[model samples]
Target chain A: MDSKKGMKRREFLKKAGVTAVAASTAFAAPNVHAKTKTYKWKMVTTWPPHFPVLGEGADDLAKWITEMSDGRLKVSVYGAGELVPAMQAFDAVSQGMVEMGHASSYYWAGKSPATQFFSAVPFGMNAQQLNSWIYQGGGQALWDELYAQFNLKPFLSGNTGVQMGGWFNKEIKSLDDIKGLKMRIPGLGGKVIAKAGGTVVLSAGGEVYTNLERGVIDATEWVGPYHDYKMGFYKVAKFYYYPGWHEAGSSTELFVNKSKFESLPADLKAIVESACARANISMLTHFESQNNKYLQKLVNEHHVKLKKFPDDVIEKFRTLSAEVIGEIVEKDPMSKKVYESYSAFKKDITQWAKLSEATFYDMNK
Target chain B: MDSKKGMKRREFLKKAGVTAVAASTAFAAPNVHAKTKTYKWKMVTTWPPHFPVLGEGADDLAKWITEMSDGRLKVSVYGAGELVPAMQAFDAVSQGMVEMGHASSYYWAGKSPATQFFSAVPFGMNAQQLNSWIYQGGGQALWDELYAQFNLKPFLSGNTGVQMGGWFNKEIKSLDDIKGLKMRIPGLGGKVIAKAGGTVVLSAGGEVYTNLERGVIDATEWVGPYHDYKMGFYKVAKFYYYPGWHEAGSSTELFVNKSKFESLPADLKAIVESACARANISMLTHFESQNNKYLQKLVNEHHVKLKKFPDDVIEKFRTLSAEVIGEIVEKDPMSKKVYESYSAFKKDITQWAKLSEATFYDMNK
Candidate 1:
């Protein structure tokens, strides 16, 4: 490729400056600090330290940056309750209490309702479609614009593909089965479940297993098979339902303090950005692999009954999902704007998906 | 986050080395040449220069590396037939004639039949499943083992997620409709089509458009909407099919000369790997957006008849796909080993995908 034609005029100037730097090395001493600067950063996450996949992703990102930058940058990751409370991750990053944060965007829905779109929506984009939308469609721009108000720069770090619906102590054969059911669910899903006459209870991860086991909560949706299996939910819940409509494809993000991110050198900035992308791919693959492995173990070894949410119940949830989404859009102007962009992207991408991914899977199955 | 607990012993050594280097700056004047060193490398790709998404991905990878390394690594890309023919990319990189090569693994099937599994297989894994397998399910380790035999290191750099079946001159109503049909298709897909009584012909990309128009080939399977729309296939082929079973999710890879890769400094090596990961995410997202956009254009403006292959026809192809795959395994021991790994991964991932992606789509649709 012709360097002149390939590079823009501004890039040409940058290249020329680099060439001059190479020439100047023959005479002058190097800037030692610039050449081997070490940056120590603190990253706060929502998951416990060393937790599988999700927490491991945070550690992987830190390790990758440290190794990739040749120790120029080191990130120390703190789990929930380590440096800050789990729910306070967003506040920590936004307030610059930490240099970085590893958390799902929806955790900050109270701060900005639009934040939910960046995480997942009920009956919305799946993992692949989410990646396509955020990276290629206009999702990232809108995300950046929305988060700028909070003084945070966000990057897509990891994804928990499509989460399972939930685990139930009894069969959910009809819409009537959902009524008055105390289920541990959260986000828009909880809202939809509540609208469907089910009692939605907010439960911590640690409390979820016992609540479901003791009939305190009749059902609970933790992640997919991998984490759920580790939590031993299958031992108590006989009916494991799937097609998590609430958090279809939950996207986790890396939140950087805008000013701190801007202060990094060009190389370090790229390192951070690329490391996020690597972790994004890595984490999802890890979840998919582990979930598949443990899912088999749950069914074959543990005798967990794999069940799909009945058609009528799914239909009810779908209808409620649409209504709940509409209500979310009407809450505020930012929600409306983000919802509009999101819905438009979802609609367009879904058309292609229906004709492509949906068809492929249907044919193969 | 406790650094003592988080950092491994090996990492501690690396960090200690950096700390010493930082301290030594007080005594040494400078290592000016090391600080300003630049690496100029050449990359050869299968697509023509500046070709949409595929070729652009190569250019993007090069640009990302250069910028990420702060001009420490500058890559010049040569498109098909510029430095070598399109099909010679693997050989060029393997022989160290080019430092890097951008191409799909399936093109090297003739060199090593096992290479086909790395690209796409008929009735095989979709892009998301492919990513999970390659990145998490030991696919990359096998890939490294396979490529190491040729002295090359491979990185999955791009993906065309769920390509369309093909463009047919006339409607395909049933299995009988495929009989004696001359089609421009290649790879294992071509073998499957031939087995189903269609006449498969090898044709170059530039020749495909004219060949289909002139009745030299009754149909052709180019990429999805964006490329097909640009190729003006709708002018001749009335039937545009859905769900490309042949190449379900085609993976494009970057091949680096193993010794050349080993020579890079720690940071530069990280820059290369991370830049490739960035390009992998970027290219797929680009394809998804452009394909979504152009698919609408093809249907609304160009009046392309979007059709799904009949269920019976799909079943026939599916049966033949299994047979073809078996024959492939029987060809060699390595092929058998790789096929075993791929099929096992496919089976495992498919279970999770069905419970998650499939169920979600079915409920919504």
Candidate 2:
């Protein structure tokens, strides 16, 4: 977490430029196409270096932008703490300290409560529904409108689909079992858990597994199988629960310094947007692919017990989620607006899903 | 379907050139950057001109390619019958009569039975699962290997999430209800329906509604609610069944003539690939958005009844689908290989979904 560990801008830019130029000009060293204007951009993320899915996805985004633009845009990515630290990514991008940033919008909920809708909500739309709202519905415009007030533009760059409920040391058979439980959850999810009488424990990513393992925290939801498997949560937790009711679909946002984004030439601008989108699709697919493979590994080899939250417990959580959302809406006008839009979209999409996706799943099972 | 309706290549190229030149030079008419070398490419699709989602998606892909490449690549899309008839699109692209094509892979199943796996299969993976397989689980590599034999390279371009099962004038109450019923279905779905004792009627898109209205076909499944609503199936059919047991997620492929694709500059090639990925994301979102809105309209305004196939009917269809898929695998070695891979991936992904997405949906409801 030391600032001293941060790579110098000049060093980062040099490496990025050289790597891109070298790859794009593999056929000819002095290719004129490679000589076209090259842009040096820096991206800071809210994930630890080489962190599973989230962090690695940012790295992939930079690489894709560089390769697709044929060296016209050389983007260097800095993991959390490597630049202005994880939580400061928004401010850094807003002040133009970095041209771009990769982080969850909910991390900045304190700045604009409405931003949390961009990340996720308890009982919110799953990844597909969220994408429908954000991309095709009016969610993106509202997201941009909210971010513009802070001098940043946001793109939904990546998602982890529907997250797992959490890994619990003991089975949560009913609502009473959740009363005194301590869990490592963040943002609005933590708030909901706290309201449901569970102790909300905020642990650093590196400490979560040990914290749960040592009974410092009784439960944690890191992500789905692919990520939790890597974090070795199953080593300590016997019960893995489903239906991440807290964060149904966690979307990662790419924040671009608005003025800097505007300054890019038309093609380079398109490169950035297109690359962000490709990264979005890549992350979801990557999550789905790896999670399934690893889920098999975790259960068959690691002997983790896969479980679903009891119906009564889920009912309790759902009720609490509604109350929590209502409170947020009641407190902030922007939150109210975003919540209404999200809720309406969710209602409509759910109807459609019931006829197609939900029905298919029900029948197949 | 007339050949005379097709636009001349030279004329299309001139118009594309003029459009790009005009837009890029709006601020300064003589800007040298606006003069980047342009490669005019033509893409032919299976959908009629201006068809919702499918055809428009192709046009959008062309537009994205044009913008992203900054005049380096100019693509013009021709819908079914514009450049060639609907069934002729694959041949046109493979023979280099056109640079690219947009159509469902199943449309070319006759040429290579394995191609249908790229589209969809009865009771197969949904959009999310399919994306995971194709993009991350080596499906795309296999697809390229298969298509390369025919002088084409394919990219997964668009998806229509889960399709509706079909529209029935009378309720499907049991397995016997399906017997002697005539339904307009296609691909493997038709075979499955036929196995269940339903008369499989193959009707063109334009005539499907009329056929259903006149009882020439007792039921049909065009797509999900969006396209189905557009086709006015709600007017003739009393019950709309769902969980599109047939093609769970229908994906459209973009076929690029291998030689033409290889001839493009590296950046331009990247543009084509990236644009296709964006189109894939866009189509799913657009479908999710529109389907929901239209489903409501279909139910409320048109007074169509939304229904799920009965448990017994679904069970029967499921068994019949397995038989149909088995027959395909038995008949074609290539199909057997593809099916094995798909089935294995589906089994794994289904396990993961059961834990996360499926469990979530189950509890939320």
Name the TM-score of candidate 1: 0.91
In model 2 chain A, which range of ten residues has the least summed lDDT?
A: A1-10
lDDT of 2 by residue, A1-365 (tens): 11222234225536544332223233211232323445678999999987888998999889888877776677899988997888899999999888899998999988988999998898898888899999998999999889999899899899999898989988898887888999899888888889988999998888998898789999998788899898988889899888788877899989999988887777778888888888899999999998877887888999999887887888888888898888989999999998899999888888777777787677555
Residue pairs with colliding backbones in model 2 are: none
Candidate 1 CA-lDDT value: 0.84
Compared with the true structure, all predictions reach lDDT values of: 0.84, 0.83
How does residue A223 of candidate 1 score in lDDT? 86
- Candidates in order, TM-scores: namely 0.91, 0.89
lDDT of 2 at B241: 82
lDDT per residue as tens, model 2, B1-365: 11221234224435544333233233211222322445678999999887998889999998988877775577888988888999999999889888899999998878988898999898889998999999998798889989999999999899999998889989888888889999998888888888888899988888998999899999888888898887788888899887788888999989999988887667777788888889999999999999978888888888888887887777788788899888888998878887888888888888778767786677555
Fraction of native A-B contacts kept, per candidate: 0.61, 0.59
**Over the stretch A1-365, how does candidate 1's per-residue lDDT look in tens digits?**
11232244225436444333222223222232354445678999999888888999999999988876666567889999999999998889888888899999998889988899999888888878788888988889989999999999999999998999889988888888889999998888899999999999998777888888789999998889998888889888898998787888899999999988887888788889999999998888889888888998999999998888877788788899899888878878988988888888888888888878888778655
Docking class of 2: acceptable
**Candidate 1's residue-wise lDDT over B1-365, tens digit each?**
11232244225436544333232323222332344445678999999888888999999999888777766677889999999999888889999888999999999989888999998899988878888889888899999999999999999999988899999988899989999999998999999999999999998777898899899999999889988887889898898998798988898999999989987777788778888888888888888877878998988998988998988898899999999989989978888998899999888888788888888777555
Residue pairs in clash, model 1: none
Residue B225 of model 1, lDDT score: 94
